[model samples]
Target: MMSGFCRTPFKYQIMKKITLILVTLFVFGCKPTEKAVETKLNYQSQVAVKGDWQVTDVSYANSDYIKVSLFDLGNTKCFVNSTWHFISNNNKGSMKINDYSCAYESDITWYINQNNEMVIKFLNGTKSKKVTTGYVVQYVPINENKFQLIEQADVLNKTQDIVLTFERI
Candidate 1:
């Protein structure tokens, strides 16, 4: 099988190789360059925090991570009777703590602070005053309906780990 004059030998082979390389480059360049982390950042920034949330568990993320259930804290009645309603499209919310009979219902104005934490501006029965320093919150959402909120005593200080989980009601 020796052809003295093969039309598609050196020139055709080089052309085929260049075509393959160009196709590969084009395909790769056209693909999306966005990453999951960057996408998450963009998604989280615009996440909605307006809804009814309940404190499901409050644990300690220290050397010994302990999960404290609402009942275990001996505040089942208070926690169960409580209602947290966050005003939509705004940073205002209310926390009502009361008994089953609604004997002591207290609503408070809450706002999303600069650290993405819930700042209780004023309580219903307490000294009506906007708190300058507020608590820190780390909202870790699993999906649209389900999420976990990690609350902290201090936001500026990272020495403490997240120790709270709130669920949507």
Candidate 2:
């Protein structure tokens, strides 16, 4: 017996519909998403208040000039604890290892422990520690390329102090 013609319209139609649906989905799904990117701010951009200040000279009572240096503790993810060191100006000061207990905010206010009576707060959110007494040190710029350490706190009995100042570098 001879076979009859077996052309089926449904098969081709189904294939066409499936191909169209797949193409439509692929075209829409492969599109790149419209993303809004946030611009990362530079360290300098946030410290606008310190922009007018520069390091000119450092002085430490009962301490050597060469022993002071600025310490960057950013590796610990504590931005607020970044400090200014007052070491012997001739020798490089030792790198500080700070144990970070909490996150730091960009706005950091530094004060000296004059009379050894000031309470130093810890990042752990506990009560501040009482120091013996030291001059609260501040970095001030007398002018461009000239700076001075303003001592507002009393230095009671501490023999040495570390002050770290940070600029763009």
lDDT of each: 0.50, 0.35
Candidate 1 — which residues are off by over 4 angstroms?
1-47, 61-82, 98-105, 113-115, 125-133, 153-162
lDDT of 2 by residue, 28-131 (tens): 99989953323332222223223333232334564332322222222212322334332222111112233355333222223322222211122222222332
Query: Each candidate's TM vs. the true structure?
Result: 0.44, 0.22
Counting clashing residue pairs in each candidate, in order, gives 0, 22
The sequence of per-residue lDDT tens digits that candidate 1 reaches over residues 89-147 is 54456765545543334445554433444444435455445444334355565666655
Q: Which residue segments of model 2 deviate by more than 4 Å? A: 1-58, 65-139, 142-149, 153-166
Location of the lowest summed lDDT over 10 successive residues in candidate 2: 86-95
The true-versus-predicted C-alpha distance at residue 12 of model 2, in Å, is 99
